[model samples]
Target: MKGRLFLIPVTLGSPDYRYVIPEKVLEIIISLRKFIVEDIRSARRFLRMIDPRFPIDESEFMILNKHTDYKDLDGMMSFLKEGSDTGLMSEAGIPGVADPGSDLVLQAHENGFRVIPLIGPSSIYLALMSSGLNGQNFAFNGYLPIKRADRIREIKNLQTMARRGQSQIFMETPYRNMKLLEDIAATLDNNIYLCIAANITHPDEYITTRTVSDWLKKGFPDIDKKPAIFIIGIKS
Candidate 1:
C-alpha cells in the first residue's frame, strides 16, 4: 500500500499560525514524521512553532527546491513507497503555487499517491480579495523579467490584458520590490488601477489600490526588501 501525500502550509511571518492556518491542518502537520520541504531549517522552525513538543530530531526530511535535480525526484518518494505518509511543505504560504513543491506533487501523482491539500492562507487570493480587482478572471504571472527593458514590455503586455477585464497578478524577489514598483509607476497606464500588497498576513501588512496617476502624485509606502504582490487591472 503506497502512502498518501499531505501538502502543508506555513505562516506568512505572522508567528501566530492560529489566524491563518486551520487547527486541523496544524494537527495533520504535527502527525507527520517525514517531509519534503523547500528549506529544512525553516520547515523545522515552522514545525517547532506549531508545537514545541514536536519530534524534530526524529523526523525525516528531504530538501526540495528550485535547485533540486529532477533525476532525484523519484527517490524523494521512497518513504511513500514504503507506506509511510509524508508531508510536502513550503517556506511560506501554501505549497505548489509559485513554489517548487509542485514538482514533487507531480511526481507523486505519476507514482499513484493520494494527494491532499490542506486549507491555509494564500497571499495571492488574499491580495486579490483586498485589492478590489477582478477576482473571477485573473492570471498569476509568477515573476516578471529581471532586465528593465524586458520587464517594462512585460508590464505593458499585462496592462493590455488588464484593460480587457482580466487581472494580472505578479510578484518579485523581496529586495527588488522597490524597483518593480518604480517600473510599474512609469510604465503602467494611468487610467488602469494598480494594487500593491506587501507583507501580507503580517503585522505590518499593507494593501492599497489606486490609479497610476494618483500613485505618482501621492507617492506610496516603503515596501523595499519586503515580500509583495502587484496587480494591474480595470476597476470595473
Candidate 2:
C-alpha cells in the first residue's frame, strides 16, 4: 500500500493573532495516526491551543528535528514502507520553506510516497505584498550572518542588488531585530528605502517604509520583540 503525507503550515501563535486551521485540516490533524514534527513539544502546544478536546497521545506523534540525527532519511523510508500516513508541520510559516521539514519531503518523494502541501499563511510573502518594494523582482535571502563583518559584506551585496531594483527580504529572531536595524542604518545609503513588516497578521502588526536616514532620525519602529520580516529596496 502507498503511504500518504501532508505538509501543513502553521503560523506562530500569538495573542494578537489567532490562526485559523480549517476544519478539514483540523480533521486531518486529529485523524492522523502519526505526525513527524519539527519540534514535538511545540507541535503539542499548538494542538492544545487549536482544540483542547483533541486528544494527542504521546505515542502518536514522532519528533523529527532536522538538525538532529533523528532525521535519518533511511528511517523515514522505513516508516513510509509501513504505509502509515505522516503529517509534517513547522513551528511557524510554511513547512519546507526555511523550516527543516523539507528533508522529509524530499526523502518521501524519492521513495514514491504521495506528498501534499496545504495552503496557509506565509509571513514572508505577506511582507513582500505590503512592502512598497519591487515585488516583480525580489529575493528572500533568509538569515543574515551573525558576525558583523560578514553581515556587513552580505548587506552591501544585497544593497547593490536593491539599487538595481531588486527587493531584498530577510529575517532575524525577534530579539535581534534591533541589531539588524542598526546594521542597516549604519551601512546602507541614507536615501535608500527600507521596509520593516513586523508582527504580520497580528493585531499589533506594523508595516512601514522609510529612508535609512529618516529611520535613524525617527529611531525605527518600536516593535516589541515580535517576529518580523524586513525588506530593503531602491525605489524604482
Candidate 3:
C-alpha cells in the first residue's frame, strides 16, 4: 500500500502557531516523521515552534526548492513506497499555491499516492476576501516583471483584465514591495482600486483597499521588508 501525502500549512508570520494553525492539523503534523520542505531551517523552526517536544533529530527532511530538478523528485517520493506517510510544507502559508511544493504534489499523484490538503491561512485568498473587490472572478498573476518597462506593461494588462470584471492579484519580494507600489501608483488609472495587504496574520498586519489616486495623495505605506500581496480591480 502506498503512504499518503499531507499538505501542511505553516503560520504566515505570527510566532504563535496555535492562533493560525488548527489543532487537527497539528495532530496530523505530530504523527508524521518525514517531510518535504521548501526551506530546511524554517521547517525545523516551525516544527519546534508548534511543539517543543517534536522529534526534530529523528525526523527526516527533504529539501524542494527552485533548484530542485525533475530527477530529484523521484527521491522525494521514495519513502512512500515503504508506506511511510510524508508531509509537504512550504516556507510559509499553504503548500502548492505560489509554492514549489506543487511539483512534488504532482509527482505524488502520478505515483498513485493520496494527497490531502489541510486547511490554513493563504495570504492570497485572505487579501482577496478583505479587498471588497470582485471575488467571483479573480486571477493570481504571481509576480510582475522586475524591469520598469515590462512591469508597466504587466500592470496595464492586469488593469485591462480588471476592467473586464476580473480581479488581478500579485506579489513581490519584500525588498521590492515599495518599488512595485510606486509602479502601481504611477501606472494604473487614478480611479482603480488597489489593495495593499502587508505582514498578513502578523501583529503588524495591514490591509486596505483604496483608489490609486487616493493612495497617491496619501502616499504609500512603509511596507519595506514586509511580505505583502497587491490586488488591482474596480470597486464593486
Show the colliding residue pairs in model 1. Answer: none
Candidate 1 local lDDT, 116-140, one digit each (tens)? 9999989999999999999999999
RMSD of 3: 0.8
| Residue 87 shift from truth in candidate 2, angstroms | 0.7
Q: Residue 223: error of model 3 in Å?
A: 0.2
lDDT of 2 by residue, 154-218 (tens): 99999999999999999987888888888888899998989999987777788998989898888
> Against the correct fold, how does model 1 do in TM-score?
0.98
Of 2 and 3, which scores higher on lDDT? 3
Each candidate's TM vs. the true structure?
0.98, 0.90, 0.98
Model 3 C-alpha lDDT per residue in residues 1-236, reported as the tens digit of each score: 78999999999988778888889999999889999999999999999888889999999999999889988999999878789999999999999999889999999999999999998899999999999999999999998899999999999999999999899999999999998888887889999999999998999899999999999889889999999999999966
* Residue pairs clashing, model 3: none
Candidate 2 global CA lDDT score:
0.80
